[model samples]
Target: MSRAKGNLAEDKACKFLDENGFMIIERNFYSRFGEIDIIATKDEVLHFVEVKSGLDYESAIQNITPQKLSRLLRTGDVYMKKNSLDVDFMYDAIIVTPQDVELVDNITI
Candidate 1:
């Protein structure tokens, strides 16, 4: 998808997360490895979120391949180190579709 589309999707994802009681800390955080779409916190645990949008949930989720996960890990490490954060964190994904949006937490490689 295009950059604009990605931004739109991320906006929606942010709103969704907000409604679900998450505090958004950052958006479009960058590092040499890649970008972490959103950083949020809830119940004292930090969440690194990846926003993926497509015609369907499967297609969007499929975009998060192993390589992408690797980059997220590396970028997340960079974020934590740069900010001197020492909190519990987990990888997550928000799948955005025309029908609905879903949050998948605790994603693992």
Candidate 2:
């Protein structure tokens, strides 16, 4: 997707998260490995979130392949180390489709 489209999807995802009571701590967090689209905290657990949008849920979720997951994990580790955040955390993905949004947690690699 184009950068503008990606940005718009990310914005929408952020809005959805905020509405659902997630406190957004950061967005577009980058490290040598890759970028994490959103970082949020809820119920004391830090979330490293990857945002993916598509015409359908299948495509959106498929975007997070193993290589992509690896990059997100690497960046998440960098973020935690840099911020000295030693707390509960997990990998999450927010899938935004034309009809609805879905949040999937603990996306273990």
lDDT of 1 by residue, 38-83 (tens): 9999999999999999999999999999999999999999999999
Model 1 alpha-carbon miss at residue 58, Å: 0.7
Among these predictions, the greatest TM-score belongs to 1
Best by lDDT: 1
Model 2 gets an lDDT of: 0.94
Question: Each model's TM-score?
Answer: 0.98, 0.97
* Collision pairs in model 2: none
| Per-candidate RMSD, Å | 0.7, 0.8
- In TM-score terms, candidate 2 sits at 0.97
Q: Model 2 Cα displacement at 72 (Å)?
A: 0.6
Candidate 2 lDDT at 86 equals 92
Cα RMSD for candidate 2?
Answer: 0.8
